[model samples]
Target: MARAATATATATASCAPRLLRAALLLLLLVAATRRAAGAPVVSELRCQCLQTVQGIHQKNIQSVKVTPAGSHCAQTEVIATLKNGQKACLNPAAPMVKKMIDRMLNKGSTN
Candidate 1:
């Protein structure tokens, strides 16, 4: 009876480390996959925002013009005329920027 009890205790103690390691490995794998899956979406959004800003700068824009809704953009886009009188497109997803755009639209409509 004493030997059986000792063997059972030994087995449980040895199994604990293996169980802990397996659980740790499972958690790491899940975290890695989640990060990998979501990374592209985050990067793409940043890329699109930067690209839109770059395009606007390249055109040497003057004042920004906002449309309540746009045919080409996801939400609203800002149109600006350059010193050379060329039009440029700007993204309006940022909070502060969107507010400014709303003000611009409202002010324009009033006049």
Candidate 2:
């Protein structure tokens, strides 16, 4: 009985480090997943716009591209391409764009 108790204690001692290591590894994986989930994937916005004249004629504007130009600590540059292929920049540095990106990024976190 004494021998069995000693063997059991030694076995548990050996398992303790392994258990601790496993827990640490699991914690690291969870941290990594959380970080990855928070990271944003770059994307381009594509859409069409229409204008009506005389309440009858319809014009189709094809493929407006919205691209990210740069990212600062608090803001980013979003370039908006017009239907005529002209490009304009919408800066997150702007109050409206900043709020929009903030809301978008926040909404992203919930998913």
Candidate 3:
């Protein structure tokens, strides 16, 4: 009976570390999932890409690029890189942005 008790205690002691490791792994996964789920949401405000081209532009946007939102925003986003290396986000489906995307697509197709 005493030998059986000692064996059971040792088995439980060995299992405790594995159980703790599993619990820690589960917590890390949950944290990572929560962080991924908290990704930036798409804004409702309509972006005017043309405005960046006209008038006294403060942004000085050098280039505009399309970025597809995967599991986050659902909609596509346009990122405008400024001359000073700053970036601004815009709506991809906006008038000027759409024109840019279409132009790029057409250019790629012809190549």
TM-score to native of every candidate shown: 0.41, 0.36, 0.42
Off by over 4 Å in 2: 39-111
| Tens digit of per-residue lDDT, candidate 2, span 22-105 | 999999999999988876564423322222122111133232233343342222335444467654545435565555556667
Reference-based TM-score, model 3: 0.42
Q: After superposition, how far is residue 91 of candidate 1 from its true place, in Å?
A: 13
RMSD to the true structure for each prediction, in A, is 12.6, 14.2, 8.1
Superposed by TM-score, candidate 1 places the C-alpha of residue 84 at a distance from the truth, in angstroms, of 34
Q: For candidate 3, lDDT tens digit of each residue in 60-92?
A: 768777756565445566777879887776655
- Stronger candidate by TM-score (2 vs 3): 3
Error of 3 at 99 (Å): 0.4
Worst 10 residues of 2 by lDDT: 49-58
lDDT score, residue 25, model 3?
A: 100
Model 3 scores what on Cα lDDT? 0.69
